[model samples]
Target: MIDKNRVFRVLQLAGLVGLLAACGPSFAAESDAAGDEIEVVPVRGGVYMLVGGGVNATLQIGDDGVLLVDTMQEDMAEHLLAAVRKLSDKPIRYVLNTSGNPDQVGGNPVIAAAGSTINAGNVAGAIADSTVGAAVVAHENVLTRMSVQDPPPPFEGWPTSTYFFTPTKDVFFNGEAIQLIYQPDAVTNGDSFVYFRRSDVISAGSIFDFTRYPFIDVDNGGTFAGTLESLNNLIDLTVPEDKQEGGTMVIPARGRLCDESEVVEYRDMLTIIGNYIREMIDEGRSLEQVLEARPTLAYDPRYGADSGSWTTDMFVETVYREFTANGSSEQ
Candidate 1:
């Protein structure tokens, strides 16, 4: 059963935690005006969701150590640590980020190094230590993005490991097969759908946001068709348990845990909206005309219009640009 209080805490993180990527990794989580508690809810198997200050991070605990899919930015790293202590003190072995977004990878430094009690006097040695507590992992494209972000992000919490495998990158730890499957041109060129074979869970970053419409970062190589394709791929990887309700649990970037049914609903909604936007664009309608139509009007109430920062209109605009711009022609 899902805990209501835990769900509320996740919502609190979504509405409160805000991260600034260009500011560097040395920054700390800002103390909340009234302070907030970090909450961890078990999803399936050993996978759990750490919710507090920023985006939802999937936590996998085992005898070997701890593995995280997304890390809330620096703002709530300490709180995240406290929450993790309740689970296990075996140390955080890997910090895997699904994309290059700050909210997703911001806490890499803090969470990854939780096991190391000894502090390094020199920054040089910490960077050189590869076998220790923390090892940040992400797609190679994520490294490329972090390196060219204007002034360039500091090396404090950068990815220590990256994969450029064509279809999947596999890692074996704690007697489970973990695969980092690439989802290119989806939310970003670096998007990855992490599959935990033993746990029967999938950690989908921004590709599956149940709280609102999909966030397509076109400038970062995201496209409409790519987004849908990734969603389809996520569904293909899922397996329902009984009554077609609960089987393969999916941990999204933020929001509630989803099963195969939820993914199908979300996919259908996006397809309908994307088709509507394409029809409008094909008719030579301007962005203004398309926005006026509000293609997602039917889904607004369920997803919530004033739910958070990213709005429904913003999603429509992204779809419009993806088809008409330099993105993939498959759509």
Candidate 2:
């Protein structure tokens, strides 16, 4: 059985823990020193981002236990589990997903099973009591897509609980009202950003990858226009702090933590690149011609398309295809 007093102690000390964590070291320096070790950084309101293990996972720890958004990959389970144990001994009440990508929900089964049983009320942190495992929650589409993969992603990683929203759905956990908002056709049809209301933090999933060009998985129901809409909606939910600097914290699928201003810059990048592609289409430029123009050249240095994966040309081609989907008649 979990200790009630211990839960309260962790909850009460969370603010101080966050303060200490924030002031301790820069994420870059710490991540460089830590090197692939799962590092936890306090965001605010007892919300934290666990980086370096796999895809970024957001942990909300409170009297309710733990509520997680995006559970990295399965291989990192033990590391992530130990990291959660470092925060609280209470059960993990819920695991929410922002994308169906393997890196996002790959650890669902292990982490969910590792969690102790809890009353349904505790799942929401203030409701009523009923027995349950740490629930896996996601948009209905994520469940559908993950179910039909070649090998079919493991069942353990599939979301046990799915919500349908023409726009968004809401859940309560760890004293925070979590909004599982949809961003259809952004990274994929299933993408949803988890907004922790009290914490003012958005676990942006892959819809807002700060690391590289927004991966428009065209084969998976993604569109440049849809991703742009997602980013604009994210900006709407953000509230900057004094001097419009840092207020609402955003934890993307990968890369450094950021605030509204950084999001705006990213949005602008997508907008500019998108408009350039649209104009090229209007000018009747072939995909090869558009690629040669290298519209993303100005931003490539900052976003880094020199290697790894997801090149700038790939992003440009995606945008070109999306904007010209109706252009066969025009050309």
Please tell me which predicted candidate would have the highest lDDT against the true structure. Answer: 2
**C-alpha lDDT score of every prediction, in listed order:** 0.74, 0.78
Model 1 agreement with the true structure over 58-155: per-residue lDDT tens digits: 88888666778888777777877888888887666678889988778777677776643212422223223434657677899998888888976667
Candidate 2's residue-wise lDDT over 65-102, tens digit each?
A: 78888888878877888889998887787889998887
TM-score on alpha carbons, each prediction: 0.81, 0.84
lDDT of 1: 0.74
Q: How many steric clashes between backbone atoms does each model show?
A: 2, 3
What pairs collide in candidate 1? 29-75, 241-247
True lDDT of residue 49, candidate 2 = 94
